[model samples]
Target: MSNLTSHEVIILGGGISGLSTAWFLRQKGISFKLFEKQSETGGVIASEYIEGSVMDFGPNSLRDRNGQIRKIAKDLGISDDLIGISEAFKTRYIVRDGKLQSLSPNISSLISTKVLSASGKIRLLKEPFIEAGSGEDESIGEFLERRIGKEAVDYLADPIFSGIYAGDIYRMSKKSVLPKLAEFEQDYGSVSWGAIRSKKEKREVKPMVLSFKKGIQQLTDAITEKISDHITYDEVLSLKKSDSGFEVATEEATYHSLNVISCIPAYNLGRILEGFEPELSAELMNIDYAPMLSVQLTFNKAEIDFITEGFGFLVPRKERIRLLGAIWKSSIFPELTNKDQHQFTLMIGGAHDRGILTEPKEQVEQEGIREFCRLMQFDARPSVIRSRLWKKAIPQFEVGYEQQKAKLDRFEGGNPGLYFGGNYQWGVSVPDCIQGAEGLAEELAAGL
Candidate 1:
């Protein structure tokens, strides 16, 4: 058998995390090859252009203050193409009493919005007196209920969770998912005080929040152009110990590298490393993920109501709606839609709604359309249904997340050439993924 040559580093999985990792490695003048399972580089950042309108399958827009993502774009020479969400419509909404309601538009609005009950607002006043918990980890639901009362958790907080994680907040680990809140409790002894202190802390540094001028995929496309020939679309069939380093086998050939970064999701990691690292793989397999299906729809701009002029709205579980939320793509970024046609995107079925995604596609599509019409009060049905299903799209940071983190720590300590990073490893956000990539690159380079 002919021998394959080796590179200084090999990146597994072609998603943003892996691509970002390779992006930094390239800047460091290090030799590396990136392998993606699919032919494309962007994993969940897939965007579709229909009728001159932009539609997103995942991550419609990233926050503007994401310094790491923004810097990466600058390095890629696409910073000028980035755009911020319409400042006039940055506020989001939540569903309550089977109707779309505007959330607090301002600090003053918090006291006026009908989204929260009178008792709920009064209960929040007690936050300064509520004591913090002494524990390794706590669920997000528990934390909110203890601090602000169940109404805040159910209406204000839970709807936000529905949009972000699609996982129930009652089971999400506060320490893992929302570390800042956890830190707030630790330092100030009360969340209300923490918020007050946080304002002063934030004042010290100006935070920039925005998204790309084109779609987010533009950044990845630029990265791919830079490192075009170096990466391959070979799926890793198995991992094995080699004389010099490690070997990864694809269907057609085997590739060797001195160092490997496994950027694949936890579920995929479980499969590829099951034999090479059984115990570690088992622990990784236990990290439950949820499916996210997005339905992108296009409409006539004139048909939309004036109320639908914002980022969109999130539906809490109590609403009993199939969709988690809808993005007013046209309102937030009109470039995503044509001037004549209004563009909107909606998401449904997360870890909490596994049962929904498990059903047939036709059913999911119909359910999504029904929910969109009912919640957004669309004048007409969607002209097109570009439904995309992400099986095991994001990892759920359940209550026992620290134990899983501990297991990953031990696994990484033992495996020198292997590295893991993504939304699964860190908090689920564009900034977090970028931070995870940079951190992983430093770790792998140090080991080498």
Candidate 2:
């Protein structure tokens, strides 16, 4: 495997992180190549076309807080392509009293919503007086319970938590997963006080929720279009240190580059770099990854009894459902919907119960239908169902996450020409991944 010529920079993995890096390199007019294991780009960001309706298998929306993502959209001349969710649909729902109940929509609802009992409401008032201990880190469940109450944590936060991370708040790290909560403890000494401070600071804050008018994949596709010529659709077998730079090996050919950026999934990265740095590889391999399964269903609008105007619903783990949450895709964006057809994207099998991910396709589909009917009260099956299983998508930021960061620090210090940056290295959202890529690009530019 000693055939291909070297380049200025070589990026492994062709997900959003890798693509964004390539895009930045193009803007800098630096020569580079991007290698992807898949035949096409967009690793987890994929969409399906069913009967003229666009359905997404991953990431239905991007938050407005994602400045990097917003900047990228603006730069691509597609900033106007963004869409906002409806106000009525702004309220989330949870299973309470064996029925779907609307959560607090606004400040008035927070004070009036029956989802919280009188005792729970009063318990929350005590949050302003509750004392947070001085500790390095704690679980999200523990932190929430300490700040508010168990009901607030279990009812208000748990369902949303389950839907987003498929992680048990009891095990998830508060410092790493929910740093805003940590910041509240640090600056205000109490979350209630932090809320007051945050309100005054809210004007400086940008929009906190958003999505592309068409689909999330538009962002990935746009980035790829900006750097399509430099990408390679080949599987990289291994990487090794060379006399001057680094050697990257694919099945049929080998290529050397002045600098290497490993953007593959954490687990995969660990294996590929094992021979080079066993200790760092071992630490990286220990970084847990949760499987993700998304099922997109399309139905005639009349077939569904309830009219969905808002985003969707989430099922808590205690609900004992086989699915996580469902996003009313058509309601969120006009481009993804048709006049007569309605679509919903159901995400299931997160970090805690990925076992459901390996189930037979037919079984998963049937289970999804059952859960949908049971939770949302649909009478019949959806007209079209498409399921995509991603076994190594969600990165698990479990307790002691600093260990992973330390390993990365050691690896980078030992390997001069090799660099690594991806979703796992930073935060897990689209904005975080884009920021990580941009930061790495700047570092690479300075080195060049």
Model 1 worst lDDT run, 10 consecutive residues: 201-210
For 1-448, candidate 2 gives per-residue lDDT tens digits of 5434565689999998898888888888888888998888988888666687877787777775636667778888888987666664686667665567676556677777766788998887788788876857888888889988998887788888777777778878888897877888878888768877877764444665666755788889888887888888889888888875898888768888779998888888888888877877788898887787788887777777766666777776666777778887777675667768888888778777767756787787678778887788778678888888888767877778866787787778888768888888867777778888888899889887
1-448 per-residue lDDT for model 1 (tens digits): 2144566687888888888888888887778888898988999888777878877788888864537667778888898888777764657788888887776457677887778899988997788888878856878999889989999888888888878888889899998887877888889888778777877754433456556666878877888899987788878887766876788887778888768888888888888888788887788888888888888888766666655456788888877777888888888887667778877788888877887556997798788888788777766866667888888787899998888888887776676676777778866776677778888777766755
For model 2, how big is the CA root-mean-square deviation? 2.2
List the global CA lDDT of all models.
Answer: 0.79, 0.79
All predictions: root-mean-square deviation over Cα? Answer: 2.0, 2.2
Compare the candidates by lDDT and give the number of the best one: 1
At residue 314, give the lDDT of candidate 1: 87
- Name the lDDT value of residue 229 in candidate 2: 82
Off by over 4 Å in 1: 1-7, 202-205, 446-448
lDDT of 1: 0.79
Provide the TM-score for each candidate, comma-separated: 0.94, 0.93
